[model samples]
Target: MPELIAPTVRLHAAWLEAHAEWGPGFHEDGFGLIPADEVESAAGFAAWVARLGDESDPAKAAKAGGAACTYRWIVEGERVLGGIALRHGSGEFVQWAGHIGYGIRPSARRRGVATWALGRMLDEARVLGMDQVLLVCAADNLASVKTIERHGGVLEGIRNTKLGPARRYWIKIDLPIT
Candidate 1:
């Protein structure tokens, strides 16, 4: 079964291969939110991995200009299927980006990978003390909208973002964490 695991160099080869398959400016939806330039080189990838560790500390995260976050790779064994990020605070960026972001490799799409990964991430959010989590997706991204809705996401509204119009949904997580 696929599970969320802490980001590690052991997955670097898989990560790089996945990115190469996706081409440039790949968005992991809620996970690999870093600038594309920051992940282009080995050194850049190393820096990004290091930054991920720092993002768990509020002070360190503040210095970097955002909320503390926990990032994980969704993998079944050694293959990296995707990634997810759970933010631990609120702010303009968080409000715009939502509390979580995630993406699945093209080869892994249409197999309920995103749905499963997202459910796991929501559980992670609950463990972090979140009562509800905001998840935003592009208005045209039917698959994502369906995934969010399948997980009990309620439509909050739409907001204009640089990327275009985004549908915002509030997912209540007061029940038992799955």
Candidate 2:
């Protein structure tokens, strides 16, 4: 269990960057975690996202206080199945989104990666003065809702975002530490 590092992708790019078995899957079931876990795409998208979350990206880093604040979810040693991005500002985060967003690769789905990843991010948030956190997901995303609940998330309300029906789950950081 490694600490979820902010923009934690590049740290483990040795596999994600060079490997062919695990790359971005457009219509194919590359990793089997996204579609297997019921996510959109589960290939190297996680890795690409990690790169976008990089503090060195310059463009993305400028708006989000550098990628050093993003979090990466790594499991099974060298594999980075998913990650969460944390932004500290009055931007797209505070309104519809929250402090973090996450995804797990297709190959690593249904194995409690979502639960552990969210848990890892929560720990990071608490350490960063975030007494409470907000997590938004589509109303139809039952799997995501369940994962959020596993970490003690309480439902705030449902919002009809432009994308679709969304649910806002709140997690209190003040609760007794587990």
Candidate 3:
């Protein structure tokens, strides 16, 4: 596998925490697992169980979608090293979470895993009819700042959210559907 686009998966806690590197971020808000399938154990299933829901509202549905998200980030073969989930714009999510969220294991941090994974998610957003998308990260998160920047994200300014302070960005996804 050349150092380019990898695969993503949706996972459970057992699979997430199984690797010592994932730690706390896997279960937080705007949180997700990379190599997404790392969460396949019975414990993982239990953690994910609380998030599954069928909602009528798009916003509500989007929240459920984020919890139920099963996409993975794959590097090389048979590796579900990371994943991303889409949070629909609604209430606080609109002002904060953006249309996508992602994570890669600590072991894989500077390998461009986030940049690669987010690019794929952006492509998916384009497929979903989103022309431009908003992404936010903590003002102190230099890693995410670089990842988003490498993916053509434009800085929009900073804002304080219920979650914390964040630097917001926008990406004009120009993918045309074939």
Candidate 4:
């Protein structure tokens, strides 16, 4: 069974295997990877993992004046499957990209990994006091649409973005009765 875990340096080799499988690009989405991130070296990967951990710290994020984000890697034993991030804030990125973003490795597609990971992130959002969360995906990504819809996401229509036309949806988080 797959489980969510914080990014760790111990899994650098496993992560590199997964990253290579995604091909050459910064499209890994939920891994919090950026164009300038040098994850090829052990030191660079460790720094990147540290950066992700800092980003998840509310105090650090506040000090940095950025969104506090929770990044989780979907893994099974030593194998890395994918990742999901729950971002908190109404910043421009959150507005354009959405509160949550995720990607499952090509080999793990159609196996409910994204769905399960998304569901888990939604729980994280709820714990952070979010009443609803936004999610955007390529307009043509029917798989993502279904995954979002399965979690009760309501379409707010498609819009053209710097990345091209994308479908936006809002998933209302049902707060657990206190």
Best by lDDT: 4
On TM-score, the leading prediction is 4
For model 4, state the Cα shift of residue 54 in Å. Answer: 0.4
* Residue lDDT tens for model 3, 99-162: 6666665665688767777877777677667788888888899999998899889999998987
- List TM-score per model, in order: 0.89, 0.65, 0.68, 0.98
Q: Give candidate 1's error at residue 176 in angstroms.
A: 5.6
Off by over 4 Å in 3: 2-14, 17-19, 24-76, 89-91, 175-178
The TM-score of predicted model 1 comes to 0.89
State the lDDT of candidate 2 residue by residue for 72-135, as single tens digits: 5454566555555554544564567655666666666788877877887787677767788888
lDDT of 4 at 68: 91
**In model 2, which runs have C-alpha deviations exceeding 4 angstroms?**
1-3, 6-68, 175-178
Q: After superposition, how far is residue 108 of candidate 1 from its true place, in Å?
A: 0.3
Over the stretch 1-178, how does candidate 1's per-residue lDDT look in tens digits?
8988887766778888887777777566645555653665678778778778788677998998777988888898888888888888888877998998888888989999889988988888887788999998899999999999999999999989999999999999975646
Q: Give the distance in Å from residue 7's predicted Cα in candidate 2 to where it truly belongs.
A: 4.4
RMSD of each: 2.4, 7.4, 5.7, 0.7
lDDT agreement of model 3 with the native: 0.59
In order of listing, the candidates' clash counts read: 5, 11, 19, 0
